[model samples]
Target: MAPGPIRVAETPLVSYLLRRADDALVLGHRLSEWAGRAPTMEEDMALANMGLDLLGQARMLYAHAGEVEGRGRDEDAFAYWRDERGYRNLLLVEQPNGDFAVTIVRQFLYAAYAEPYWRAMMASGDATLAAVGAKAEKEMAYHVRHCAEWVVRLGDGTAESRARAAAALTELWPFTGELFEVDGTDRTLIAAGIAVDPQTLREPWQRTVIQVLAEATLEAPPAGFMRRGGRSGRHSEHLGHLLAEMQHLQRSNPGAAW
Candidate 1:
């Protein structure tokens, strides 16, 4: 039987879905910032399209979460009404999309996390989540491949490109810990079968990261103290700046429907 949208009953399921969706929303917003700023026209289109895909996925997940919450909130309501402190997205996604190298590194790192997370989630006890996870798996598969190829190409391409990509990867590496950190809510979901423990994907994700870096001729940065706290709604200063730009028009013209 073809899977359908996720249907969740527990609040943890609602919270977890929102967390994943919000993660995508924030990252997609970052990519959208590159619409015309990318190094080349083709890359610009590619980034924009990728942003669109992320946005679409975010909307779908957010809508499903809203239904689970049973609070009559829609996707826009959930997105616009929540404060930054209320958002559960990780700090990694909120990092600014600086250069092409930086963008590729961020995408490569996040895509690795997204792949295994959703793949395991395809079997979520919640029916809708399973379906959403299954479909998202296909889309995210391409994102991983595209980002991986760029990482390899740039890392092995030229002196300048290699340095830049390597630097980007190093800067982005530490934030990755947040992806597989299972907090309290996750414990609840794990017991209930509504969510997969983030730790479960740790090994596979590491293998993916390691293999891709090897192919890219990139060295893994040494383990260092990671800066955490995003899942707690405590974000880096960058999130507020990003929200201001993203919500500028909406806040300025309240309820102004296009």
Candidate 2:
């Protein structure tokens, strides 16, 4: 095992996988909270399926992250053992879903951000990274479809639904910025040809999201400084509560496993 030459760190790949896993895990957990609370049976199925897709994405990304970072942990360990400080998830994913509109808006925005990130990452020199992106692209596309459909339906349906959707967008649109800001670690990846420029992903993400909203008869939230700071782990207050719930068993019974 010690026969290889010196290996440079692939921090971008490692960081990318960690970010992706955390996003999926947090959002998937949010969606799962609505398992039986959706307004209708069909909506329950839709949300549940989205949750499954995100959870599946989380597992793959977390497993890859553990491999690349040599963390000696699997997806479950990473997910269940982390305290709030150790989690790298975005704040938006942990927001409580107050209504169907909030859920739709949140999912749509995340899918909008994820789709392009995955599409561009499909070319990573790392075959495992590229393959993971290739597999996730399809699922992410479906997530966009389902959320976009809900966007249109809710936006164009009834006055109440339209207002609700619009309100949801107003609150959720700001969090979209987290997916685009490239930091020091991100710059390394960009220089190494292993990661996309997060700055560049913004325009396409906006165009596609706007087109979907336009078709849905909804307008963009007014331009302004959107909420930020999720990438550096300065999460909103909800993260503590979420981690407390998610990590309780792990903290209570160290190394307990099924």
Candidate 3:
């Protein structure tokens, strides 16, 4: 006999899916901001493609979450309607894209974590989520490679480039801890085998990051107090501005369609 589908309760499942969608949505927007201003035209295209990929992933997750929540909201509603406090994206993604080095560093850190995360998520009891994870894993592999290449290039480049990369790493490192923090939602999902625990991604992510830093001849910043609370809707000031701009078109003409 064939195995039955792994059933996930609506509440925790919906919340977890929303968090996943929000992370992708926010990061995609951040990457898209580099559309015309990248260091090179080729880089400009690369970032745009990556941004689109993330946005697509977010759309799928949001749609699934909406179905799970039994809400009238669709992907557009979730993406454009929610205020910053209503969003559950990690703080690391909402940080400003400081400069070329900063952007590359952020992408590298996130890709490193996400690649492993999605790989683990492929085994989720939720078949829809598992399928999504399988597809995203392929994209994330490329993302990780692209960002890692940039990190190596910048870190081993001119003195100025190396210093900038280091500075970006220092500024972003503290926020990474929140990526691995487990909360009640994660615990519930983990118990149901419907979600991968973020905590398990940390050590492997660290090893991967450390190896890349070594190859780039860069030093890893000392671990310190990690910021948390993005999962609970407490976001930094930057997210509000991002939301204002992102939701402008939709909010300005409510119910308008292309």
Q: Per-prediction TM-score, please?
A: 0.93, 0.91, 0.95
lDDT string for model 1 (1-258, tens) is: 332223334477777888888899999999999977888898898888878878988999889988878877678766765667777898999998888999889988888888888889899998888887897777778888989899999988899999999999889888988988887789998999989888888888899889988998999899887878887779999998998787666566655587
Prediction-by-prediction clash tally: 4, 0, 0
**lDDT value for candidate 3?**
0.89
Put the candidates in lDDT order, highest first. 3, 1, 2
- How high is the CA lDDT of each candidate model? 0.84, 0.81, 0.89
Runs with alpha carbons beyond 4 Å of true place in candidate 1: 1-10
Off by over 4 Å in 2: 1-12
Residue 52 error for model 3, in Å? 0.8
Clashes of 1: 4
Which run of 10 residues does model 1 get worst, by summed lDDT? 1-10
Question: How far off is residue 96 in model 1, in Å?
Answer: 0.3
Top TM-score model: 3
Which is the better candidate, 2 or 3, if ranked by lDDT?
A: 3
Off by over 4 Å in 3: 1-10
- For candidate 1, list the clashing residue pairs, or say none: 5-128, 6-128, 6-129, 7-128
